[model samples]
Target: MDAFICAGMMIIGRGISRGCIGARTTCLPGWAGVASSRRRNRHRVESSARRPFGKRLERFGVEQGMALIKDEAVVLRRLDFSESSQVLAVFTRAHGQQRVIAKGVKRATRQRASVGIDLLERGDIVFSQRPGGEERLSPLTEWRQLDHYPHLRADLARYYAGLYAGEAVAMLTEAHDPHVGLFDGLRKYLADLSSDEPGLLLARFLWLLLTEIGLQPELSVCTSCRRLVTEDRVLYFSSRSGGAICRDCEPASIEKFQLSVGATKITRGGPTDARGVRAALTMLDYHITEILGRPLRAARSMHATVVKSVSGGG
Candidate 1:
Protein backbone atom coordinates (compact mmCIF):
# COMPACT_ATOMS: atom_id res chain seq x y z
CA MET A 1 0.00 0.00 0.00
CA ASP A 2 2.77 2.42 0.91
CA ALA A 3 4.63 1.68 -2.34
CA PHE A 4 1.45 2.16 -4.33
CA ILE A 5 0.82 5.62 -2.82
CA CYS A 6 4.41 6.69 -3.47
CA ALA A 7 4.22 5.54 -7.06
CA GLY A 8 0.87 7.22 -7.60
CA MET A 9 2.16 10.49 -6.16
CA MET A 10 5.23 10.36 -8.43
CA ILE A 11 3.07 9.89 -11.49
CA ILE A 12 0.58 12.62 -10.49
CA GLY A 13 3.39 15.06 -9.52
CA ARG A 14 5.16 14.51 -12.79
CA GLY A 15 1.92 15.19 -14.68
CA ILE A 16 1.29 18.38 -12.65
CA SER A 17 4.84 19.62 -13.16
CA ARG A 18 4.58 18.94 -16.88
CA GLY A 19 1.22 20.65 -17.13
CA CYS A 20 2.03 23.77 -15.05
CA ILE A 21 5.73 24.38 -14.47
CA GLY A 22 6.51 23.37 -18.07
CA ALA A 23 4.59 26.17 -19.74
CA ARG A 24 6.18 29.49 -18.71
CA THR A 25 9.71 28.25 -19.17
CA THR A 26 9.21 26.77 -22.60
CA CYS A 27 12.65 27.94 -23.63
CA LEU A 28 15.67 29.74 -22.28
CA PRO A 29 15.90 33.29 -23.43
CA GLY A 30 19.20 33.99 -25.16
CA TRP A 31 20.20 36.00 -28.20
CA ALA A 32 16.74 37.50 -28.55
CA GLY A 33 14.90 34.26 -27.81
CA VAL A 34 11.54 33.98 -29.54
CA ALA A 35 11.09 30.26 -30.27
CA SER A 36 9.47 27.39 -28.36
CA SER A 37 12.20 24.75 -28.74
CA ARG A 38 14.87 27.14 -27.43
CA ARG A 39 12.62 27.99 -24.50
CA ARG A 40 12.15 24.24 -23.70
CA ASN A 41 15.89 23.72 -23.76
CA ARG A 42 16.18 26.63 -21.37
CA HIS A 43 13.69 24.91 -19.05
CA ARG A 44 15.67 21.67 -18.97
CA VAL A 45 18.91 23.51 -18.18
CA GLU A 46 17.28 25.30 -15.25
CA SER A 47 15.36 22.34 -13.77
CA SER A 48 18.29 19.92 -13.75
CA ALA A 49 20.74 22.12 -11.85
CA ARG A 50 20.10 20.88 -8.33
CA ARG A 51 21.84 18.89 -5.59
CA PRO A 52 20.55 15.50 -6.80
CA PHE A 53 21.30 16.38 -10.45
CA GLY A 54 24.30 14.38 -11.74
CA LYS A 55 24.85 15.20 -15.42
CA ARG A 56 27.86 17.40 -16.16
CA LEU A 57 27.77 19.94 -18.95
CA GLU A 58 30.41 19.80 -21.68
CA ARG A 59 33.40 21.93 -20.64
CA PHE A 60 33.96 23.55 -23.99
CA GLY A 61 36.06 26.71 -24.41
CA VAL A 62 33.18 28.94 -23.16
CA GLU A 63 32.04 26.23 -20.71
CA GLN A 64 34.65 26.68 -17.93
CA GLY A 65 32.43 29.72 -17.31
CA MET A 66 35.38 32.05 -17.68
CA ALA A 67 32.90 34.30 -19.48
CA LEU A 68 31.37 34.96 -16.08
CA ILE A 69 33.96 37.36 -14.74
CA LYS A 70 33.55 40.88 -13.42
CA ASP A 71 33.82 43.20 -16.39
CA GLU A 72 33.69 46.98 -16.81
CA ALA A 73 30.98 48.00 -19.24
CA VAL A 74 28.87 50.85 -20.56
CA VAL A 75 25.09 50.53 -20.56
CA LEU A 76 23.61 50.51 -24.09
CA ARG A 77 19.89 49.83 -23.55
CA ARG A 78 17.47 48.11 -21.12
CA LEU A 79 14.12 46.41 -21.70
CA ASP A 80 11.60 45.36 -19.06
CA PHE A 81 10.73 41.66 -19.01
CA SER A 82 7.21 40.23 -18.87
CA GLU A 83 7.63 38.86 -15.37
CA SER A 84 10.64 40.00 -13.30
CA SER A 85 14.18 41.24 -13.96
CA GLN A 86 15.35 43.58 -16.73
CA VAL A 87 17.12 42.82 -20.01
CA LEU A 88 20.31 44.80 -20.53
CA ALA A 89 22.24 45.49 -23.70
CA VAL A 90 25.74 46.60 -22.88
CA PHE A 91 28.96 47.50 -24.62
CA THR A 92 32.12 46.64 -22.74
CA ARG A 93 35.31 48.45 -23.53
CA ALA A 94 37.10 45.16 -22.86
CA HIS A 95 34.88 42.47 -24.44
CA GLY A 96 32.68 44.44 -26.83
CA GLN A 97 28.86 44.07 -27.14
CA GLN A 98 26.96 41.56 -24.95
CA ARG A 99 23.60 40.93 -23.32
CA VAL A 100 23.42 40.74 -19.52
CA ILE A 101 20.27 39.64 -17.70
CA ALA A 102 19.88 41.65 -14.50
CA LYS A 103 17.46 39.40 -12.64
CA GLY A 104 15.02 40.67 -9.97
CA VAL A 105 15.11 44.16 -11.43
CA LYS A 106 11.42 44.53 -12.16
CA ARG A 107 9.54 45.26 -8.90
CA ALA A 108 12.21 47.27 -7.12
CA THR A 109 14.88 49.43 -8.67
CA ARG A 110 18.10 47.40 -8.74
CA GLN A 111 21.25 48.76 -7.14
CA ARG A 112 23.36 47.22 -9.90
CA ALA A 113 21.41 49.24 -12.43
CA SER A 114 22.83 52.41 -10.92
CA VAL A 115 26.11 51.20 -12.39
CA GLY A 116 25.12 50.77 -16.07
CA ILE A 117 21.34 50.52 -16.56
CA ASP A 118 20.83 53.76 -18.43
CA LEU A 119 22.51 56.16 -20.81
CA LEU A 120 26.14 56.98 -20.02
CA GLU A 121 26.11 54.66 -17.00
CA ARG A 122 29.45 52.92 -16.61
CA GLY A 123 30.83 50.60 -13.94
CA ASP A 124 32.08 47.24 -12.76
CA ILE A 125 29.57 44.47 -13.59
CA VAL A 126 29.46 40.86 -12.48
CA PHE A 127 28.34 38.45 -15.24
CA SER A 128 28.24 34.69 -15.48
CA GLN A 129 27.00 31.80 -17.62
CA ARG A 130 25.24 28.94 -15.84
CA PRO A 131 25.37 25.34 -17.02
CA GLY A 132 21.59 25.22 -17.34
CA GLY A 133 19.33 28.23 -17.10
CA GLU A 134 15.76 29.20 -18.06
CA GLU A 135 16.94 32.43 -19.62
CA ARG A 136 19.02 33.39 -22.61
CA LEU A 137 22.25 35.42 -22.44
CA SER A 138 22.59 34.12 -18.84
CA PRO A 139 21.49 35.95 -15.73
CA LEU A 140 23.88 38.60 -14.54
CA THR A 141 25.20 37.32 -11.22
CA GLU A 142 25.89 40.84 -9.85
CA TRP A 143 26.26 44.48 -10.87
CA ARG A 144 26.91 47.86 -9.28
CA GLN A 145 26.86 51.29 -10.91
CA LEU A 146 30.24 52.98 -11.03
CA ASP A 147 29.62 56.18 -12.98
CA HIS A 148 27.04 58.01 -15.03
CA TYR A 149 27.61 60.80 -17.54
CA PRO A 150 24.99 63.34 -16.49
CA HIS A 151 25.41 65.24 -19.73
CA LEU A 152 23.90 62.38 -21.74
CA ARG A 153 20.57 62.56 -19.97
CA ALA A 154 20.44 66.33 -19.36
CA ASP A 155 19.35 67.26 -22.89
CA LEU A 156 16.45 65.51 -24.62
CA ALA A 157 17.75 65.80 -28.16
CA ARG A 158 21.17 64.63 -27.13
CA TYR A 159 19.67 61.79 -25.15
CA TYR A 160 17.52 60.61 -28.07
CA ALA A 161 20.47 61.06 -30.40
CA GLY A 162 22.52 58.84 -28.11
CA LEU A 163 19.81 56.20 -28.39
CA TYR A 164 19.84 56.58 -32.16
CA ALA A 165 23.60 56.21 -32.09
CA GLY A 166 23.26 53.13 -29.90
CA GLU A 167 20.72 51.60 -32.32
CA ALA A 168 22.98 52.30 -35.28
CA VAL A 169 25.80 50.60 -33.46
CA ALA A 170 23.59 47.70 -32.44
CA MET A 171 22.22 47.03 -35.92
CA LEU A 172 25.46 47.26 -37.89
CA THR A 173 28.04 46.04 -35.40
CA GLU A 174 28.65 42.32 -35.14
CA ALA A 175 29.00 40.64 -31.76
CA HIS A 176 32.54 41.12 -30.36
CA ASP A 177 33.51 43.43 -33.19
CA PRO A 178 35.79 46.06 -31.69
CA HIS A 179 36.78 49.27 -33.37
CA VAL A 180 38.30 51.74 -30.89
CA GLY A 181 37.71 54.71 -33.17
CA LEU A 182 33.95 54.03 -33.43
CA PHE A 183 33.59 53.83 -29.66
CA ASP A 184 35.59 57.03 -29.17
CA GLY A 185 33.51 58.82 -31.78
CA LEU A 186 30.33 57.68 -30.04
CA ARG A 187 31.53 58.85 -26.61
CA LYS A 188 32.67 62.24 -27.89
CA TYR A 189 29.59 62.78 -30.04
CA LEU A 190 27.27 61.83 -27.19
CA ALA A 191 29.02 64.23 -24.82
CA ASP A 192 29.29 67.00 -27.40
CA LEU A 193 25.82 66.77 -29.02
CA SER A 194 24.31 68.23 -25.83
CA SER A 195 26.27 71.49 -25.68
CA ASP A 196 27.06 71.71 -29.39
CA GLU A 197 24.92 72.69 -32.33
CA PRO A 198 22.57 69.93 -33.48
CA GLY A 199 23.34 70.03 -37.19
CA LEU A 200 27.09 70.13 -36.78
CA LEU A 201 27.15 67.37 -34.17
CA LEU A 202 24.87 65.11 -36.23
CA ALA A 203 26.89 65.78 -39.37
CA ARG A 204 30.14 64.91 -37.65
CA PHE A 205 28.63 61.75 -36.18
CA LEU A 206 27.23 60.52 -39.54
CA TRP A 207 30.53 61.28 -41.23
CA LEU A 208 32.39 59.31 -38.61
CA LEU A 209 29.96 56.42 -38.79
CA LEU A 210 30.24 56.35 -42.58
CA THR A 211 34.01 56.56 -42.53
CA GLU A 212 34.25 53.94 -39.79
CA ILE A 213 32.07 51.57 -41.85
CA GLY A 214 34.08 52.46 -45.01
CA LEU A 215 30.88 53.73 -46.65
CA GLN A 216 31.94 57.38 -46.69
CA PRO A 217 31.54 59.22 -50.00
CA GLU A 218 34.39 59.91 -52.37
CA LEU A 219 34.17 63.68 -52.02
CA SER A 220 37.90 64.50 -52.43
CA VAL A 221 37.41 64.43 -56.19
CA CYS A 222 35.00 63.22 -58.85
CA THR A 223 33.98 59.72 -57.78
CA SER A 224 34.11 58.57 -61.40
CA CYS A 225 37.10 60.42 -62.97
CA ARG A 226 38.95 61.67 -59.83
CA ARG A 227 38.79 65.19 -61.25
CA LEU A 228 38.48 67.91 -58.59
CA VAL A 229 34.82 68.80 -57.83
CA THR A 230 34.91 72.28 -59.32
CA GLU A 231 31.92 74.64 -59.44
CA ASP A 232 29.56 72.48 -61.46
CA ARG A 233 26.15 73.41 -62.81
CA VAL A 234 24.29 70.65 -60.93
CA LEU A 235 25.03 67.69 -58.57
CA TYR A 236 23.29 64.31 -58.58
CA PHE A 237 23.19 61.53 -55.95
CA SER A 238 22.26 57.88 -56.53
CA SER A 239 22.22 55.10 -53.97
CA ARG A 240 22.92 52.36 -56.54
CA SER A 241 25.70 54.44 -58.09
CA GLY A 242 27.28 55.78 -54.83
CA GLY A 243 28.04 59.44 -53.97
CA ALA A 244 28.00 62.64 -56.10
CA ILE A 245 28.15 61.82 -59.79
CA CYS A 246 29.81 63.98 -62.42
CA ARG A 247 27.64 65.27 -65.26
CA ASP A 248 28.71 62.36 -67.47
CA CYS A 249 28.27 59.71 -64.79
CA GLU A 250 24.79 60.80 -63.62
CA PRO A 251 22.37 57.92 -64.19
CA ALA A 252 18.60 58.08 -64.59
CA SER A 253 18.34 56.53 -61.12
CA ILE A 254 20.25 59.49 -59.65
CA GLU A 255 18.11 62.40 -58.53
CA LYS A 256 19.69 65.84 -58.25
CA PHE A 257 19.94 67.72 -54.96
CA GLN A 258 21.14 71.28 -55.44
CA LEU A 259 24.57 71.93 -53.88
CA SER A 260 25.94 75.43 -53.44
CA VAL A 261 29.62 76.18 -54.23
CA GLY A 262 29.84 76.96 -50.51
CA ALA A 263 28.46 73.51 -49.75
CA THR A 264 30.67 71.71 -52.28
CA LYS A 265 33.83 73.17 -50.65
CA ILE A 266 33.17 71.07 -47.50
CA THR A 267 35.63 68.22 -47.77
CA ARG A 268 36.08 67.72 -44.03
CA GLY A 269 35.12 69.40 -40.80
CA GLY A 270 37.65 70.49 -38.19
CA PRO A 271 39.04 74.03 -37.81
CA THR A 272 39.12 75.07 -41.46
CA ASP A 273 35.52 74.74 -42.62
CA ALA A 274 33.75 74.89 -39.25
CA ARG A 275 31.35 77.41 -40.76
CA GLY A 276 30.14 74.94 -43.38
CA VAL A 277 29.37 71.99 -41.09
CA ARG A 278 25.61 72.15 -41.73
CA ALA A 279 26.19 72.13 -45.46
CA ALA A 280 28.36 69.09 -45.11
CA LEU A 281 25.72 67.50 -42.90
CA THR A 282 22.99 68.13 -45.46
CA MET A 283 25.16 66.59 -48.13
CA LEU A 284 25.88 63.59 -45.95
CA ASP A 285 22.22 63.29 -45.01
CA TYR A 286 21.21 63.11 -48.66
CA HIS A 287 23.71 60.34 -49.26
CA ILE A 288 22.82 58.36 -46.10
CA THR A 289 19.06 58.57 -46.54
CA GLU A 290 19.41 57.90 -50.24
CA ILE A 291 21.24 54.69 -49.45
CA LEU A 292 19.29 53.68 -46.32
CA GLY A 293 15.92 54.46 -47.99
CA ARG A 294 14.74 56.47 -44.98
CA PRO A 295 15.59 59.63 -43.09
CA LEU A 296 17.07 59.40 -39.60
CA ARG A 297 14.27 59.95 -37.11
CA ALA A 298 16.59 61.90 -34.81
CA ALA A 299 17.49 64.34 -37.57
CA ARG A 300 13.86 64.84 -38.51
CA SER A 301 12.95 65.18 -34.83
CA MET A 302 15.55 67.92 -34.41
CA HIS A 303 14.09 69.82 -37.33
CA ALA A 304 10.61 69.59 -35.74
CA THR A 305 11.63 70.34 -32.11
CA VAL A 306 14.02 73.24 -32.66
CA VAL A 307 11.45 75.44 -34.48
CA LYS A 308 14.28 76.68 -36.68
CA SER A 309 17.33 74.83 -38.03
CA VAL A 310 19.18 78.09 -38.70
CA SER A 311 21.22 77.90 -41.87
CA GLY A 312 24.97 77.57 -41.10
CA GLY A 313 26.79 74.74 -39.28
CA GLY A 314 26.04 71.51 -37.29
Candidate 2:
Protein backbone atom coordinates (compact mmCIF):
# COMPACT_ATOMS: atom_id res chain seq x y z
CA MET A 1 0.00 0.00 0.00
CA ASP A 2 2.86 2.43 0.79
CA ALA A 3 4.57 1.67 -2.53
CA PHE A 4 1.25 2.20 -4.51
CA ILE A 5 0.64 5.61 -2.80
CA CYS A 6 4.20 6.78 -3.63
CA ALA A 7 3.73 5.82 -7.28
CA GLY A 8 0.37 7.74 -7.50
CA MET A 9 1.97 10.84 -5.95
CA MET A 10 4.81 10.72 -8.49
CA ILE A 11 2.27 10.50 -11.37
CA ILE A 12 0.26 13.49 -10.00
CA GLY A 13 3.42 15.59 -9.65
CA ARG A 14 4.39 14.87 -13.29
CA GLY A 15 0.88 15.93 -14.47
CA ILE A 16 1.07 19.19 -12.51
CA SER A 17 4.52 20.03 -13.94
CA ARG A 18 3.36 19.30 -17.50
CA GLY A 19 0.22 21.47 -17.02
CA CYS A 20 2.33 24.40 -15.90
CA ILE A 21 4.76 23.99 -18.84
CA GLY A 22 1.91 23.70 -21.37
CA ALA A 23 0.20 26.81 -19.96
CA ARG A 24 3.45 28.77 -20.14
CA THR A 25 4.03 27.70 -23.76
CA THR A 26 0.47 28.57 -24.79
CA CYS A 27 -0.03 31.86 -22.94
CA LEU A 28 3.46 33.34 -22.93
CA PRO A 29 6.03 32.29 -25.52
CA GLY A 30 9.55 32.53 -24.11
CA TRP A 31 12.61 34.52 -25.35
CA ALA A 32 13.12 32.23 -28.38
CA GLY A 33 9.61 32.76 -29.67
CA VAL A 34 9.89 36.50 -29.11
CA ALA A 35 13.18 36.66 -31.00
CA SER A 36 11.78 34.61 -33.89
CA SER A 37 8.77 36.96 -34.17
CA ARG A 38 11.06 40.01 -34.14
CA ARG A 39 13.17 38.52 -36.93
CA ARG A 40 10.08 37.85 -39.07
CA ASN A 41 8.82 41.41 -38.58
CA ARG A 42 12.23 42.83 -39.49
CA HIS A 43 12.31 40.78 -42.67
CA ARG A 44 8.91 42.13 -43.67
CA VAL A 45 10.09 45.68 -43.07
CA GLU A 46 13.22 45.22 -45.19
CA SER A 47 11.25 43.57 -47.99
CA SER A 48 8.74 46.43 -48.05
CA ALA A 49 11.52 48.99 -48.05
CA ARG A 50 13.10 47.35 -51.11
CA ARG A 51 9.87 47.38 -53.13
CA PRO A 52 9.31 49.88 -55.98
CA PHE A 53 7.44 53.09 -55.35
CA GLY A 54 4.37 51.96 -57.24
CA LYS A 55 4.25 48.60 -55.46
CA ARG A 56 4.60 50.21 -52.07
CA LEU A 57 1.87 52.67 -52.92
CA GLU A 58 -0.34 49.85 -54.14
CA ARG A 59 -0.11 48.16 -50.76
CA PHE A 60 -0.63 51.38 -48.82
CA GLY A 61 -3.28 52.66 -51.20
CA VAL A 62 -5.41 49.62 -50.50
CA GLU A 63 -5.61 50.65 -46.87
CA GLN A 64 -5.88 54.39 -47.62
CA GLY A 65 -8.87 54.15 -50.01
CA MET A 66 -6.95 55.01 -53.18
CA ALA A 67 -5.71 53.17 -56.25
CA LEU A 68 -2.18 53.32 -57.63
CA ILE A 69 -1.58 53.18 -61.38
CA LYS A 70 1.58 52.98 -63.43
CA ASP A 71 1.71 53.30 -67.21
CA GLU A 72 3.52 54.61 -70.28
CA ALA A 73 1.93 57.83 -71.41
CA VAL A 74 2.20 60.82 -73.72
CA VAL A 75 1.37 64.32 -72.64
CA LEU A 76 -1.39 65.59 -74.91
CA ARG A 77 -2.04 68.90 -73.23
CA ARG A 78 -0.70 70.99 -70.35
CA LEU A 79 -2.18 73.90 -68.48
CA ASP A 80 -0.58 75.95 -65.76
CA PHE A 81 -2.43 75.52 -62.51
CA SER A 82 -0.25 77.58 -60.19
CA GLU A 83 3.19 79.00 -59.78
CA SER A 84 4.62 75.59 -59.05
CA SER A 85 2.03 73.20 -60.47
CA GLN A 86 0.47 72.23 -63.79
CA VAL A 87 -2.52 70.24 -65.08
CA LEU A 88 -2.11 67.75 -67.90
CA ALA A 89 -4.09 65.54 -70.20
CA VAL A 90 -2.08 62.35 -70.67
CA PHE A 91 -2.91 59.38 -72.87
CA THR A 92 -1.71 56.19 -71.24
CA ARG A 93 -1.30 52.87 -73.03
CA ALA A 94 -2.97 50.74 -70.36
CA HIS A 95 -5.25 53.24 -68.63
CA GLY A 96 -6.36 55.44 -71.55
CA GLN A 97 -6.80 59.19 -71.26
CA GLN A 98 -6.30 60.69 -67.80
CA ARG A 99 -6.33 64.26 -66.58
CA VAL A 100 -3.74 64.62 -63.85
CA ILE A 101 -2.37 67.53 -61.89
CA ALA A 102 1.34 67.69 -61.23
CA LYS A 103 2.04 69.50 -58.01
CA GLY A 104 5.39 71.34 -57.66
CA VAL A 105 6.55 70.21 -61.08
CA LYS A 106 7.45 73.77 -62.06
CA ARG A 107 9.34 74.69 -58.94
CA ALA A 108 12.85 75.88 -59.70
CA THR A 109 15.76 74.65 -57.64
CA ARG A 110 19.50 75.14 -57.65
CA GLN A 111 19.96 71.79 -59.41
CA ARG A 112 17.57 72.21 -62.36
CA ALA A 113 15.56 74.81 -64.19
CA SER A 114 11.75 74.61 -63.85
CA VAL A 115 10.66 74.19 -67.45
CA GLY A 116 7.63 72.09 -66.35
CA ILE A 117 6.04 69.35 -68.41
CA ASP A 118 5.77 70.16 -72.09
CA LEU A 119 3.03 69.12 -74.49
CA LEU A 120 3.51 66.02 -76.68
CA GLU A 121 6.22 64.42 -74.53
CA ARG A 122 6.26 60.67 -73.88
CA GLY A 123 7.08 59.28 -70.43
CA ASP A 124 6.49 56.62 -67.83
CA ILE A 125 4.06 57.91 -65.24
CA VAL A 126 2.94 56.90 -61.77
CA PHE A 127 -0.31 58.29 -60.48
CA SER A 128 -3.03 57.81 -57.87
CA GLN A 129 -6.78 58.17 -57.90
CA ARG A 130 -9.63 57.64 -55.47
CA PRO A 131 -11.86 54.62 -55.96
CA GLY A 132 -15.12 56.49 -56.54
CA GLY A 133 -13.66 59.72 -57.91
CA GLU A 134 -12.75 58.85 -61.48
CA GLU A 135 -14.37 61.97 -62.81
CA ARG A 136 -12.07 64.05 -60.66
CA LEU A 137 -8.50 64.61 -61.77
CA SER A 138 -5.84 62.15 -60.60
CA PRO A 139 -2.64 63.20 -58.90
CA LEU A 140 0.51 62.60 -60.92
CA THR A 141 2.98 61.37 -58.30
CA GLU A 142 5.98 60.54 -60.49
CA TRP A 143 7.00 61.21 -64.08
CA ARG A 144 10.12 59.92 -65.84
CA GLN A 145 10.59 61.35 -69.30
CA LEU A 146 11.17 58.72 -71.96
CA ASP A 147 11.27 60.68 -75.19
CA HIS A 148 10.86 64.35 -75.92
CA TYR A 149 11.04 63.94 -79.73
CA PRO A 150 13.44 66.86 -80.10
CA HIS A 151 13.23 66.60 -83.88
CA LEU A 152 9.61 67.63 -83.79
CA ARG A 153 10.58 70.78 -81.94
CA ALA A 154 13.18 71.70 -84.58
CA ASP A 155 10.73 71.62 -87.51
CA LEU A 156 7.54 73.69 -87.57
CA ALA A 157 5.72 71.22 -89.81
CA ARG A 158 6.51 68.22 -87.62
CA TYR A 159 5.59 70.08 -84.46
CA TYR A 160 2.20 71.06 -85.84
CA ALA A 161 1.59 67.51 -87.00
CA GLY A 162 2.38 66.20 -83.54
CA LEU A 163 0.02 68.72 -82.03
CA TYR A 164 -2.70 67.68 -84.46
CA ALA A 165 -2.28 64.04 -83.52
CA GLY A 166 -2.33 64.81 -79.82
CA GLU A 167 -5.43 67.02 -80.18
CA ALA A 168 -7.26 64.34 -82.12
CA VAL A 169 -6.55 61.77 -79.42
CA ALA A 170 -7.75 64.14 -76.71
CA MET A 171 -10.98 64.94 -78.53
CA LEU A 172 -11.97 61.56 -79.95
CA THR A 173 -11.19 59.18 -77.10
CA GLU A 174 -13.22 58.95 -73.94
CA ALA A 175 -11.51 59.10 -70.56
CA HIS A 176 -10.40 55.78 -69.02
CA ASP A 177 -11.13 53.86 -72.23
CA PRO A 178 -7.98 52.01 -73.23
CA HIS A 179 -6.97 51.80 -76.90
CA VAL A 180 -3.72 49.92 -76.99
CA GLY A 181 -3.43 49.79 -80.76
CA LEU A 182 -4.01 53.49 -81.12
CA PHE A 183 -1.40 54.26 -78.50
CA ASP A 184 1.15 52.06 -80.23
CA GLY A 185 0.38 53.56 -83.60
CA LEU A 186 0.78 57.06 -82.21
CA ARG A 187 4.17 56.20 -80.79
CA LYS A 188 5.29 54.74 -84.09
CA TYR A 189 4.00 57.72 -86.00
CA LEU A 190 5.84 60.16 -83.76
CA ALA A 191 9.05 58.18 -84.01
CA ASP A 192 8.88 58.07 -87.82
CA LEU A 193 7.80 61.68 -88.23
CA SER A 194 11.42 62.84 -88.36
CA SER A 195 12.23 60.66 -91.39
CA ASP A 196 8.96 59.81 -93.13
CA GLU A 197 6.90 62.26 -95.13
CA PRO A 198 4.76 64.10 -92.59
CA GLY A 199 1.56 64.09 -94.67
CA LEU A 200 1.69 60.35 -95.39
CA LEU A 201 2.51 59.47 -91.80
CA LEU A 202 -0.27 61.68 -90.47
CA ALA A 203 -2.80 60.17 -92.87
CA ARG A 204 -1.90 56.63 -91.84
CA PHE A 205 -2.15 57.55 -88.14
CA LEU A 206 -5.54 59.21 -88.65
CA TRP A 207 -6.88 56.14 -90.41
CA LEU A 208 -5.55 53.93 -87.63
CA LEU A 209 -7.17 56.11 -84.99
CA LEU A 210 -10.48 56.12 -86.86
CA THR A 211 -10.46 52.37 -87.26
CA GLU A 212 -9.53 51.83 -83.60
CA ILE A 213 -12.47 53.97 -82.43
CA GLY A 214 -14.92 52.28 -84.85
CA LEU A 215 -15.44 55.45 -86.90
CA GLN A 216 -13.71 54.36 -90.10
CA PRO A 217 -15.71 55.31 -93.19
CA GLU A 218 -16.67 52.50 -95.54
CA LEU A 219 -14.92 52.68 -98.88
CA SER A 220 -15.95 49.60 -100.89
CA VAL A 221 -19.73 49.93 -101.36
CA CYS A 222 -22.33 52.66 -101.66
CA THR A 223 -23.28 53.38 -98.05
CA SER A 224 -26.87 54.41 -98.89
CA CYS A 225 -27.93 51.62 -101.29
CA ARG A 226 -25.37 48.94 -100.34
CA ARG A 227 -24.43 48.50 -103.98
CA LEU A 228 -20.95 47.36 -104.90
CA VAL A 229 -18.92 50.31 -106.22
CA THR A 230 -16.92 49.60 -109.33
CA GLU A 231 -13.45 51.09 -109.70
CA ASP A 232 -14.12 53.23 -112.80
CA ARG A 233 -17.24 55.04 -111.51
CA VAL A 234 -17.17 58.41 -109.84
CA LEU A 235 -17.25 58.15 -106.03
CA TYR A 236 -18.26 60.69 -103.43
CA PHE A 237 -17.55 60.12 -99.72
CA SER A 238 -20.18 61.27 -97.31
CA SER A 239 -19.42 61.26 -93.61
CA ARG A 240 -23.11 61.62 -92.80
CA SER A 241 -23.99 58.68 -95.09
CA GLY A 242 -21.15 56.70 -93.41
CA GLY A 243 -19.04 55.92 -96.52
CA ALA A 244 -18.67 56.12 -100.27
CA ILE A 245 -21.84 57.27 -102.01
CA CYS A 246 -22.79 56.51 -105.64
CA ARG A 247 -23.67 59.23 -108.13
CA ASP A 248 -27.32 58.43 -107.46
CA CYS A 249 -26.84 58.72 -103.69
CA GLU A 250 -24.61 61.81 -103.84
CA PRO A 251 -27.43 64.37 -104.11
CA ALA A 252 -29.15 63.03 -101.02
CA SER A 253 -26.00 63.37 -98.90
CA ILE A 254 -25.97 66.79 -97.29
CA GLU A 255 -22.18 66.56 -96.78
CA LYS A 256 -20.12 65.01 -99.55
CA PHE A 257 -16.57 65.22 -100.85
CA GLN A 258 -15.60 64.16 -104.38
CA LEU A 259 -13.02 61.39 -104.44
CA SER A 260 -10.61 60.78 -107.31
CA VAL A 261 -9.94 57.23 -108.42
CA GLY A 262 -6.42 57.41 -107.01
CA ALA A 263 -7.62 58.68 -103.61
CA THR A 264 -10.24 55.97 -103.39
CA LYS A 265 -7.74 53.34 -104.37
CA ILE A 266 -5.20 54.57 -101.84
CA THR A 267 -7.82 54.53 -99.08
CA ARG A 268 -8.77 50.98 -100.13
CA GLY A 269 -5.32 49.49 -99.44
CA GLY A 270 -3.71 50.35 -102.75
CA PRO A 271 -0.28 51.85 -103.38
CA THR A 272 0.09 55.42 -102.06
CA ASP A 273 1.58 58.49 -103.78
CA ALA A 274 1.90 62.08 -102.60
CA ARG A 275 -1.23 63.52 -104.20
CA GLY A 276 -3.37 60.52 -103.31
CA VAL A 277 -2.25 60.64 -99.69
CA ARG A 278 -3.12 64.31 -99.40
CA ALA A 279 -6.56 63.72 -100.87
CA ALA A 280 -7.27 60.86 -98.49
CA LEU A 281 -6.04 62.91 -95.54
CA THR A 282 -8.30 65.84 -96.48
CA MET A 283 -11.30 63.54 -96.72
CA LEU A 284 -10.61 62.02 -93.32
CA ASP A 285 -10.04 65.42 -91.77
CA TYR A 286 -13.34 66.66 -93.15
CA HIS A 287 -15.16 63.70 -91.68
CA ILE A 288 -13.52 64.25 -88.30
CA THR A 289 -14.42 67.95 -88.37
CA GLU A 290 -18.05 67.10 -89.11
CA ILE A 291 -18.12 64.65 -86.23
CA LEU A 292 -16.62 67.16 -83.82
CA GLY A 293 -18.76 70.03 -85.20
CA ARG A 294 -15.67 72.23 -85.51
CA PRO A 295 -12.40 72.35 -87.41
CA LEU A 296 -9.33 70.97 -85.67
CA ARG A 297 -7.17 73.90 -84.66
CA ALA A 298 -3.80 72.24 -85.14
CA ALA A 299 -4.87 70.83 -88.50
CA ARG A 300 -5.74 74.28 -89.71
CA SER A 301 -2.36 75.60 -88.61
CA MET A 302 -0.57 72.64 -90.18
CA HIS A 303 -2.32 73.03 -93.53
CA ALA A 304 -1.52 76.72 -93.67
CA THR A 305 2.11 75.99 -92.89
CA VAL A 306 2.24 73.30 -95.59
CA VAL A 307 0.79 75.63 -98.18
CA LYS A 308 3.26 78.31 -97.30
CA SER A 309 6.16 75.85 -97.51
CA VAL A 310 4.99 74.74 -100.95
CA SER A 311 4.52 78.31 -102.22
CA GLY A 312 7.83 79.41 -100.83
CA GLY A 313 9.59 76.50 -102.56
CA GLY A 314 7.82 77.31 -105.82
lDDT of each: 0.52, 0.71
- Per residue, candidate 1 scores C-alpha lDDT tens digits across 196-280 of 7655566667677777777777665656665666654565544455566666666544465655444555445632244455456
* Candidate 2 segments whose C-alpha is farther than 4 A from its true place: 1-63, 269-271, 306-314
Question: What C-alpha lDDT does candidate 2 achieve relative to the native structure?
Answer: 0.71
Q: Per-residue error at 170 for model 1, in Å?
A: 2.2
Which prediction has the highest TM-score against the true structure?
2
Clash count, candidate 1: 11
Clashes of each: 11, 0
| Candidate 1 Cα deviation (angstroms), residue 252 | 4.3
**Which pairs clash inside model 2?**
none
Would you estimate the TM-scores of all the predictions? Answer: 0.63, 0.76
Q: Per-residue alpha-carbon lDDT of model 2 for 1-314, expressed as tens digits?
A: 00000111122223222123221121111112212232446565445446553444442222245666889999998999999778999999999999997766676544345677789888878777888788988877567678888889888878888898899999999999999999999999899988866766777788889889999888888999999887689899888888899999899887898986555654555326655666676787888998899988887886765423331222
